[model samples]
Every structure is written in structure tokens, then in C-alpha cells.
Target: MAQPRKMLLVDDNDESRYQLQTLLEFAGEKVVTRTCEKTITNIEDNLFALVINANSLGDYSLETITEKYPHTPIILVDSNKNHPLIQQQHDWRVIGSLALPLKYPDMMALIRKCESFKPEDLPSQTINSGNTEVLFKKLVGKTPEITKVRENILQLTDSDVNVLITGESGSGKEMVAKNIHYLSKRSNNKFVAVNCGAIPSELLESELFGHEKGAFTGAMTKRLGRFEVAQGGTLFLDEIGDMPLPMQVKLLRVLEDRTYERVGSNTPIKADVRVIAATHCNLRKAILEGRFREDLYYRLNVFPIEIPPLRARKEDIPLIVQNLLQTLEARHKKKIRLSSTALKALNDYDWPGNIRELSNLLERLTVEFSNQLIDAAEISQKLKQQGRITPSRIPEARLPEGDFDLKELLSNLEANYIKLALEESDGTVSRAAQRLGLGRTTLVEKMRKYQIDRDDISETDS
Candidate 1:
């Protein structure tokens, strides 16, 4: 039979330790109790799943335990939510944090999470050598830049470290995170994703750590927090740069100690969760400007991964388009194909919104155009009507007598047209090409010929 999971509980308080011991034993776990000053050497060689205690566990900080046993999860309990020692240690996988005294249900639930914990319970996928090759194929293109990203993913396979993904809004940051999770040892765990920007600050804490019945005026029932739900899994903090300062502090504490209290409860709970955070914003700048926490930045930056924008890797546009088209067609139950002219148009425009815009456009096209092969003219007409790109109005300045410089005017017009095409298509070259009377390849050539820098405008606005 498989051996029962063992848990080490370190606390100076007799009542708290005894209470926890009873609870753990009731849950069918083998509990080992030790005072803060007690030697932890016995745990060093055993397969203890978790270590639970306050920040001052006898004489050591949770970081000491984390350093000694990197793979074994540790949950820290602290009454002071804003403790600095706890904040600095927040980078690791902390499942929960609780205050003094304890609530039974929440604590028991946390223990259940730990007992049920398995690497496969997380939401990450598995990417083997063959899967990596498949992903490369699906991702498209063979640019040295893209090759480097793939290489980084490969390198991360052996380590279970926190990762911070940065990229433009639609540049597939989450996809990269999923690929990393699947490629790593945590592939079997659940992958719980959270949009830090989407949840209101007031709700963020509850959303992340959950709330007990009547925790707040509006909270009528018990709810499991993302951290608890994502136990033995990956918690993806999307748009992490947008998290509020207060929330950051709370989050920092959780990372430092591996424990958290629910919205209304004071009982300390422990969780065995992994975290993966992503954002398009420049966190360094945020830290300098007092927008993001410096300590938190360091914590999340342990494994930084930057996803290049679509324009930077234009070679992948065709492949991305192919993949997007297939996906859309499957979803919509259509067999639409892009004409050579349409395909060429798609290849030429600059994609500013990245993959997301491309995917959205494909969905729209499949829905509106159906099975008929889409042509450049029809595509261009549709884009113009949508106001994605507008033609440049004739400039009254330097009008020669009754006429204007046709060559100069045409150049201006072309520039305006490409700009309009870019905007109409949400900065996607392929979509812009389809919207313009050009092929994707032709659009690329024209962009090069026109000496246009798509990023200039993108940077100015974004």
C-alpha cells in the first residue's frame, strides 16, 4: 500500500499545535509535531508534503525551510498580514495564510487540499520532446528569435520555478505559460488562471483566497479561493502588473509564508500551490514610479519570459493565420479558404494587437464570408467599412496652382492607406492585407518598400 502523507507542524503554542494535530490526524494524515526550536533533521530525509508554522518558527524564517527543501511545499501562518519578512519570502508557492487562532472548516479544507495534492492535479499540460516539436510546428515560422523562445521553454523543463511572462496584450503570454507548465514537472496539476486586472480590488482577495459564509455583507455562502482550489496546481496570475498595491502586499505575504486567511476567517490555512504570473506592462518602470512593489517584482522575476510581438516575428504570420483559420473553421463549421490575393494581403500588414486580433478576425471572416474563398477586394471593402483604415485626405498644402503632386500625393495616399489598413486590421499585417487590395507577401514587400515602422505608432499609442 502507498504510504500516508506526512506533515510537519511547528508552533510555539500548545493549544494551536494540539488543535492542528487532532485535525490532521482526523484527516488520515500522519502528523509530526515540533516546537519552533526542535530539530527538523528527521524531516530532511523523509517525503514530508508540507511544513506549517508561523513566520518565527522557533528560530527560523519560512525562507530557511524553503531553501533547505526546495521541492517540499511550506505554508506559513502569520497574524500580521503586512510583515516584511513574510513579504520577502512570498515568491515561492504559498497555498494559504491565516491569522492567530483558527477556524475548523477552512483549516480542514486546506488540509484536504494538501492531502489530495499531486503534481498532476495542476492545470498545466505535458510537452515532451515530440510535443515540443509539435508546438514549434503549431507556433509556425523558423525565426532565430522564436527558436530562442522554444529553447528557453526546453531549459525550464527540469526546474519548478516561478515565471513572469511579458508581452503585448494579444501576444500569447498565457499560451506560453501553459506550454511551460505542460513542459515542466507540474504538468498533472490544475492550471487556474486569474486576470488581476479584471477582478476589482475589493473582490480580488476573495476571488483568490475565497471567503467564508457571511465573510462580508454580500458574501452569503462559503467559497473556495483560487489558491485553495488550485492546490497542487498552477495558479496563473494574468495581468499581474495591474494588481492593486494592497493586494500585492497580501500576495507577497502568501508567497513568503505559504499560508493565507480567508476573507472573514482568522484561522491559518495552508495550501500547496504553484504560481505563474504574466503581464504586458513594464514592472521595472512601475516599481520606479511607485506603481509596482520592488520586492514583489524580484519574486515574480525569478524566471522571466518575454513574448515577442507579431511584427517582430512576421515570418510566423502565415502559419498563425493557417492555424487560426483552421480553428475558426472548426468552431464555425465552415470550410472557408483564403484566396492567393487575400493571403498575400494578410502577409503584408503589420499586426499590432498580435495573435488575438488575428484570431478574432478569422472568426469574424468565417462567420460572415462562410465557405466562399475570400478575396482581397471583398476583404478590403469590409475593412474600410469597419473604419480599420482610412484613406489620406488630399493635403491642401503645397497644391501646385490647380493640381497637387500626384507622385507625392500617391505616396501620401499609400502611406495613409497602409496606416488605415493597419488600424482597421488592429495592426495585423495579414488582416490588413486582406482589407487592402494586396497579398500578404505583397503587403510585407510594400511595408519594406514604404520604409514604414509599425512599431513607431504602436509604441506612441500603447
Candidate 2:
């Protein structure tokens, strides 16, 4: 017989608490539910695990709990992104935050993580993976679109080609870049990523190319640049379109000559780094407008991989939810599951912010309504209250008040989003398609399928 698992779930939502009980029971674990108003003094020592909803525990002091139960591992389920206590702390070894819309896999992962550690070693950084780490976990789904992207990644991984990944701001571009580098021969080497748009132009040169001794006024000592440090590895240039014209010229030289002169140094240093540049901007248009360089664009566009947006890959939502939930549960130390209605609401909505937005919503759900099975009503209510969740903005179908065909509405929404995005982008099919996370060619095909006009759109090769 298996030992019964004891769990303590603290949250205010009645629905979440009950649903969480059912899920944990089904998982063959005994669960003990409580409200944040109840003190930790009530909890027995050596319980299976303790999961706290950070939102409800706002009034309750954390320092008190840490002092009282220093032996027990505590996981914090956080719904809100800006938690006062969470932001104030620097290193919280015991406290891991999970954003909501509860997920079962995430819960199990968290439990497993807790079980792997001893109470005496409670506040430690290293998490023991054991056999769990080797478990073949799929990060996302295998939609036809995603399958093709995966195939392309596999093909690109073995080669040392400089790749250009173009997509919308939050369309999982970095994840794709990391996959490519990890799968490639340069997996052993460092994968250094630099956000070209975020850094000031004045500071970007030194960041990419090492600064020499007395390189500038504040040049205290010689420091190796990102490129030199990432030697025999991959360098990810995010938001490349924002690079200044002067920086673009230097970047172009680096790409072509594979050598760069450090600041305050005449001698050129060899940089054997594979470049993977990403941008949300239309580089070709930027080049035409003289905002970006044409030569640099071609140099980085050797192997272009464009990630589809959340709207285009609706099929992947379920898988993404699962993956994200598992990640959250492990971090938050709570077990939460989603209801059919909740899943439908997710499917119906056109996620403008993409995967990042979905993850945020889930995190919120886990903290605000943990310990319950979350349905559509709860999801809508919570999202509405937060101002982050909006009703499905798809234009094609008139969704009546009563029960409707979710799958049909979703398909219509996807097609309509693509068609409208294309139209709004001045028929610049690529931009419109990119807005929908579709390839230029895919957008043209989708336009034809939806009986929309493709003639007015401009398709400049990237």
C-alpha cells in the first residue's frame, strides 16, 4: 500500500478549494484545505506538503511562518504579477511563485520537487531532478504548423548558419532560438542573448565587442565582449531592427569578416560565434526607410525561422497550458487543475500578447483561486476584474449568449484575425501575416482560402 500524501491548500475561493480537493484525491493524495485567515499554528508538522495562495496570505506575515515552520518546504501560488512581498525579496529559496489558472502537471511537479528534498535542507537553491529530469516532457504541442517549425529547427541545428528569427514581441521567439542553439553542435558553448532594442546605442558597441583598457572615459579595465565570451557558441541578437546605423555597419563587418576591433584597440580579434538575430520590426521596410541597413539584413537572414503567433496555433493552447501548469506547480508548490469551461474561454479568446500573456493569466488563477477546479465563469470573472482579460475580439462569428460551438468559433476567429490583420497592415501581407504569426506565404494562402484579397499586399523578401 502506498503512503497517503498530506497537503495543505490555503485560498479564499470556494470553487477552487473544492476542485483542488477532487484533483488531488484522484491523484491518490490526501488533501487538507484551509483559508489564509487560519494560522500556520494549526498545521501539523511533517505533513505531506504546504501550499499557500500568496494573494490570500497578504494579511498574514511570511516572516512568522518562516520562523514557525523552518523545516517544511513552502510553495507560494501567486496570481498577481506585482506582489509586494515577492518584489521586495532578493533570494527566496523556500518561496517559488506560480502564476495561475491551475494546472495538474505543474502541481505534480511541485510535489515531486518537494518530496525530493528533506525538511532539514528546506532553504536551498539546488533542486534534485532524480529520474524526473529525464522524463520526456513536451514543452508545447505538435500542431502541423509547430511540427514544421520543429522540422526546420532540426535541420538548422546541425549547421553553423547565422539564423534570423522574426516574430511579434511575445511570440516565443526566444524559446525557439534557445531550442535551435541547444539542439545544435554548439550546445556545449554558451548561448549569449543581447536585446539590441533595450540597450542604449552608446553602450551597445561595448556590449557586443569587448572594451579595451581605457576604451572610454569609464574604461576601468579590459573586459571581454558578448561575442568573445560566446566564442564557439551562439549569440542571440534580440530586437535587431532597433540597432543604430553605425552599429549596423559594425555588425555587418563582424558578420562578414568574423573579426572585430575592441574599443580602444587597433588589433582586430577573431569572433567564431554563430549569430541568431531576431526582430519584430520589418527590416526590409526599415532598410528602405534607411532606419536599418540592407547589407546587415541579408547577412543575418541566412536561415530565417518565423514563429507563429498564439492565434494561428490554437491547437497548441492545451499543450501550452499543460506545460505552463507543470512549470508553475513546481515553482508555486500547489496542485491546480482547469475545467472545460476555462479551457473553452482560453480557446475562444484571441491572445494578442501570445504565450507570455497566457502564462501570466494562469499564474494569476493559481494564486487567486487555487485549491479548486477552475471553470469558465471563474476565469472570465477573474480576468475581467484584473483588466488584463478581455472578451474574444474575433469579428467573424456572432457568439450568442447561450452555449455555442467553441471549435467553430475558434476557427472562424483565427481566419478572421488573419484576414483583418492583413487588411489593417495596408495589405502588406507579410506584416499582417506576421501580426497573426503566419508566414507571408501562409498568409497569402489563408487569404485565398478565406476569399480575401491578396493583390494589394506587398511581399518583400526578407
Candidate 3:
């Protein structure tokens, strides 16, 4: 018969240790209890699936245990629920932390999670960093830059180290984050994504940390925040650079302590989710202007991965388009082929909108033209129109070479269109909103996003 999984429990509290040992044994686990830190040496050669440490065990060499037993997961038991040091378990290489007075449900659940980790399931973090063809193929590219990114993603699957992914908007930063999470040890759990920039600053905290019922006006029901919802999983913070300054402080604290409370409650909950942050904004610039916290920047910059813009890696365009074409074909139930000349035209144009724009254009073509073969003439027409290279009023407009941030592009386009519509309407907001097909409130918000001065457009028109 296969031997039962073994767990090493360390605690000086006799009753506490006995309780945990009995629970593990009942669940078919080989539980080894060490009453003194000195006795840890006795099991130096033993192989354990997990190590549970209670604060009563006193100071022991965490590095020694982590290094010697690299595959074994270490979980901490917090006797004092509010103890500050418990927050730094991740930094100390502990994979998880449990509240004091262990409940069998919570303890067993965590141990069972750890027991599922097989050494062969993940390659060593330091070995074969680039050999992940399975995950690498998900991204369409063979360039060295993309290969390096694949290597980084492969390395991240084994541990819950914080990652900061930087790239222009729509450059697949979040997609890469998802690939890492889905292929990771925590794959069975959740993957929650939050757009830090979209939510208003006033409500961002409650959205992230959740709140108790009646915590505030209209908070009629208890809610689970993204952190809690993502527990034992991964949390992806998209557009992280736009997060308000105040929230940065709170985020850094939770990152440090691996814990947070509901908006209206003081009870600490373990923030066990792996964090992956992405941004198109230049954070260093934000830091210099005192907008982003320097300390928080460093904390989140543990392992940095910067994705190259689409223009920088144009060679990958063919493969990307091919994959996208297959999807379009299946969805439309039609055979669609791009003429060689049409493919060349696509390769020639600089894709400021990146992969997202490419996918959108293909979908639009499939819907509009159906199964008709796309040729160079149609490709050129649409490419120039969307690239903003040749509008009816403007004969030839050259976009700045290889420089277009998705947010900035959208904002600028909206602002310019609103200006044109206002000019055409003789500077009337109602008429302009009508022409732009936007509600007045949404138009106003877009105007504010672009910071367009009302007087400027009207003055030019007059």
C-alpha cells in the first residue's frame, strides 16, 4: 500500500500540538510532532509534504528548512491573531499562514492543497527556464524577446512571488499573467482581475477589501472583496500605475503583512493570493512627480517583466493573425483566406493598437464581408482609415513613429472627435453629444478624461 503523506508539526504548546497531530492522523496523515526547536534535527533526513509551525515553537532557522526541503510547503499558525511578524511569512519563504486555535476544516483544507503539489508538476524555478513549450505556444511568437517572456512565465509557475508586468495597453500583459496562473500550483483556485484605473478612488478600497453589511450607505449586504475572493489563487491588478496614492499605502501594508480587514471590520483576514500587476503608464515618472509611492514601487517590482510592443516585434504578426483568423473562421462557419498581398499590407502597417486592434479588425471583416477572400485593396483601405493615416478631411496624417499608448490613443481620439463634432454643431454640447452617439454625461466624462477645455474648441471654430 502507498504510505500516507507525512507532515511535520512544530510547537511548544503540548495541547495545541496534540490537537493538530490527532487531526492529521485522523485524516490518514503521518504526523510528526516536535516540542522543541532543537528536536527538528532529528527529522533532518525525513521527507515531509508540509511543515506547520506554531509561534510557541520559538525561533527556528526558516532558511535552513526552506533550502533543505525546497519542495515542502511551510504553513504558519498564528497564536496571536494580530501579530505583525506573521505578515512576513511569504518573505520568510512560508507558503501559508493560519489563525491560532486551528480548526480542522481550515487546517485540513490547506494541508490537502499542499499534498497535491508534485515535484514533477512544475520544473525547478532555476532549471529549464525556457523549455515550457506548452505554455510558450500560447503566445504567438518565436523572437528572442518573446522567448525570454515565456521563460519568465515558466519560472513563475512554481511559486507565488509577486510579479510586475509592464507594457503598453493591449500588449497582452494580463494574458501572460493568466497563463502563469492557470499553469501554476494554484491552478485549481481562482484568478481575479481588477482594473485599478477604472474604479473611482473613493470606492476602490471597498471594492478590494470588501465591507460588512451596513458598513456604508447602500452597503445592505456583506461582500467578499477581490482579495478574499482570490484567496489561495491569483489577483491581477491591471493598470496598477493609475491606482490612487492613498490606496497604494494600504496595498503596500497588506502586501507586507499578507492580511487585510473588511472595510468596516477590524478582524484580519489572510491575503494569501498571489499578486501580478501591470501598467502602461511610466511609473518612474509618476514616482518622480510624487504621485506613486517609491517604496510601494520597489515592493511590487520584485520580478519585473516588460512586454514588447507589437511594432517592435512585427515578425510575430503573421502567426497572431493566423490564429485569430482560425477563430473567426470557426465562429462564422465560413472559409476565410487572406491573399498574400493582403497579408503583406497588414505586415507593413504599424499596429499602434497592438494585438487587440488586430483581432478586432479581423472580427469586423469576418462579420462585414463574410467568406469573401480579403485582398490588398480592402486591407489598405481599412488600415489607413483606422491608423488615422488618411481621413476624408485630412489627406495624410502621420502618427508619431512607434508611439501609441492605448489609453492615450483612445482619449485623444475621443477628445478630437468631440472637438470636431462641437465645431460642426457650432459649439453645442447637446448637438455634439448627439452627433457622437454618446449620452451627455458620458461625453462629459470623456471630455474630462482628455482634459479638453471648452473654450479652446469654440474659439478655434469662431
Candidate 4:
């Protein structure tokens, strides 16, 4: 004879609560129904196997309940799982949502899913697979688009090849570069990151190659450039495409000659550090326009890695939300959850700001909606205010609602179709091409014409 599993059914609706309790009892499970927080809070540990909240359980916070009883399975019963408010609570890893007049088979499935739940199954989990640290876990994604990025990161470590990571602002170019430095043989040495665009053109040379005490009027003391500071390590040049034309010539010299001189010093310094550059601009286009050096472009583009935008890899949103929530919760000591509707809204909208924007939004939401469920409506409002989410991509069909030009409309429809295929196919160009009934080369050409990034299509070379 097996011992009966304890289940707590919470519902403010008396009739609904009684019905659920009776159903559980009829199903041969030991059941307890409670409507108040105090009642459930007082229940001893190792007592309940599951906690089911019907509709909204007033004060008995689901976040608190899940955290306090991590082992106990918590299910939020709702009419619609996609409800913005309901979807917000998925972060707690609820044992699936139960619909009204829930079926017995669904209950059994939840029980089985709960039993199989492991902490490591979450994207926020810190994993140790042999000696190599899984740094990309925090990057938090399982899609092939993101998985390919991880594969590239791993490959980057075995060699000291100069890497050029191209991605939109806030898409985590520097973070990826940081991971490369930490995972490299030069991990012990200094890892210096410089933003070429942020520094003025006049001071840019001094910043990269350093300056002697008498190099300039402001140079009262000897300064070590980023290259010298990063000796025997790695130097991350952010927004490298923004470097001035003259600086590009100097940079090209350093790359080819493996040496540089300080602003006032004639003696050249041997730069043993590895270079990893990143930019949001189209470097090839920049080269053609004479804004960026063509020679420097080839030197830095030796091993290119382009990060996919958040909208392009919407599959990564849930994992990213989970990972961000884990840290935000631990820091704030408050639980923040996103409803499935909210998640979908976030995933549906085009993220112009990428991961950095997503992270900032999560942080803001964490504080604003502390311990409260965030619905799709709130997410929509917030996204609108930030001008981060675009409504054009929301519809399942690729048709535009309000449009003037047939040519423009058709182009948008085609682009939307391609975007959907790439997303559905997990950014694999070949797979997306197959789905679109186009040759791989033809799709690649179209993507180029449309200015669709390779990462947005798929990180794979295919």
C-alpha cells in the first residue's frame, strides 16, 4: 500500500474549493483546502506534495509559497494560460497551469511533471561539466541560434585568433568578449575593454597606445595604453568600426607588425595581447564609404562572430527571463514573475535594444512589480513607453494592417515570412530556406539585400 500524497487546494470561491477537494479525495489523494495565507504558512514542512491555487488566491502569495517550499509542486489554476497576469507567474516553474473543471489526466500529468522537476533543469542553473566552466549558461538559451554562439565561444578558446564580434548595441558583444578572455590561456593577465566610439578622436590614440609625460599639454604623467595594459592577455575593442580614419591606420600597423609606440615615444612596444573587436556598424559598408579602413577590416575580421538580436531569437527569452529573475530575486530578496502572456508579448515585439535593453527592462519590472504578477497589458504599456516593442511583427499572418505602397507591403510581407521561417527553424539558414522554398544561396542573397544579419537568420554558416 502506497502512502497518500498530501495536496493543498487554495480557492477563495467556496463552491470551487469544495469541488476540487472532493475531486482530489475521489481520486484517492489526501487533500486539504485553504483560503488564507496564515493557514498554509502554518502548515509544517514535508507535509504537502502539491499546492493548487484556483484563480487568484488573495494573500497567499504564489512566489512566497514556491520559494518557501521549493520541493512542493505549485499550480496556478486559470481559464487562460496565456492571460498576461497568469503568464507572469510561470517564472516560479509552476507544475503547469490547470484549466477550469480540470481533467483527471491533466492532474496526473502535473504530478508526473512535478516529480521530474530538477533545479538544474532551469537555465539559471550554474553547471559544472568537467573542468571547463559553462559561462554561457548565464547567457541562458537553448535554441540553435544561441547554442551556435556557445560552440563558437568554445572554439575561440583553443586558439589565439583575433576575433571580431559584430552585433547591435546592447546585444552583448563585450560580454561575449569578456567570456573569451576569462576562458583563454591569458585568463590570469589583464583583460582591458575600450570603447572606440566613446573616446574622442584626438585622445583615442593616447588611450590605445598610451602617452608619455610630455606627449601632450594634459599629459603630466606616463600612461600605459590599453594594449600595454593588456600585455600577454586580451584587448576588447568595442565599437571598433567607430575608430577614426587615422587611428585605423595605426591599428592596422599594430595588427600586421604586432607592435605599437606611445604618443611621444619612438621605441615600439611588442604587443603580445590578443585582439577581439566588436561593432554594430556594417564594417564592409563603412570600408567602402571610406569611414573605416579596409586593411584594418580584414585584419580584425579574421574570426567573425555576430550575436543574434533578442527579437530574432525569441526562443531565448524565457531562459533569459529565468536567469535574470534568479539574480534579481536573490539581490532584491523579492520574487518577480512574468506571465506567459507577458513573455509572449515580450517575445512577439521586436527588441531594438537587444539583451542590454531586455536586462534593463527586467530590472525595472523587478522593482516596479515586486512580488506582483505582471500581465501582458503592463508589458505592452511599458514596451510602448520605451519604444522598444514594434506592433508590426505581432500578427501571426505576415500581412500589414495599414499600408500605402504595394511594393513596400509585398517587401514587408516577404521579410516577415522569412523572419518567421528563420525563427521557426531556429535560425538555421538551410532549414529556413527549405521551408521558404528557396535555395540556400538565393536566401543568403535575399538576406543580404534585405540587410538581415546572418545571426538573425541563423548563426550557422549554412
For TM-score, the strongest prediction is 3
Whole-model alpha-carbon lDDT for candidate 1: 0.69
Q: Give TM-scores for every candidate, taking all chains together and pairing residue i with residue i.
A: 0.57, 0.56, 0.60, 0.57
**How many backbone clashes can be found in candidate 1?**
48
Task: Candidate 3: give the clashing pairs.
Answer: none
Question: Which lDDT tens digits does candidate 3 get at residues 1-462?
Answer: 865556777777878788877777887887777755544556444445545555664565555555556657677777776664454343213546678667878777777667655432222222233432242323667677777888788778677889999986557787788777876777657889887855667889999999999999999999999999999999999878778899999999999999999999999999999999988778999999998999998988899999988888888888878766765665576556789998898888887667776776777777777878999998887766555322565546567678678787866776778776654433445445666789766877877877865556422100
Candidate 3 segments whose C-alpha is farther than 4 A from its true place: 1-133, 388-462
lDDT for position 278 in model 2: 90
Global Cα lDDT for candidate 2 = 0.70
lDDT per model vs. reference: 0.69, 0.70, 0.72, 0.72
Per-model tally of clashing residue pairs: 48, 21, 0, 7
Q: Give the per-residue lDDT of model 4 (tens digit) for 1-462.
A: 865557767677788778878877887777777665754566644444555554555655665665656646566676676754355433435545677778888877676666665543333533343553354435567777777777788787669999999887667788778767766667646779887754657889999999999898989999999999999999999878768798898999999999999999999899999999988789889888888887788899889898988888888888888877786676677777788899888888777767766766777788888899998998888776555223554547654577569887779868877776665443546556767899777987888878776454322110
Off by over 4 Å in 2: 1-139, 385-462
- Candidate 1 structure quality by residue, lDDT tens digits, 1-462: 876557777777887788767866786778778775563554444544564656547567665665555545555666676865444332233445555565667666566555554421222112345423223323445677666677777778778777888888778777777767655566546778887865657789999999999988989899999999888878899888878899999999998888999999998789677788988778999899898999999888898888888888888777777766765654567857888898777666566567776665666788888888998887676544443433464345564678667998888878878876666443556556667878767887888888865554341111
Q: Residue 226 of candidate 3: its Cα lDDT?
A: 97
Q: Report model 4's TM-score to 2 decimal places.
A: 0.57
Worst 10-residue lDDT window, candidate 2: 126-135
Lowest-scoring 10 consecutive residues by lDDT in candidate 4?
453-462
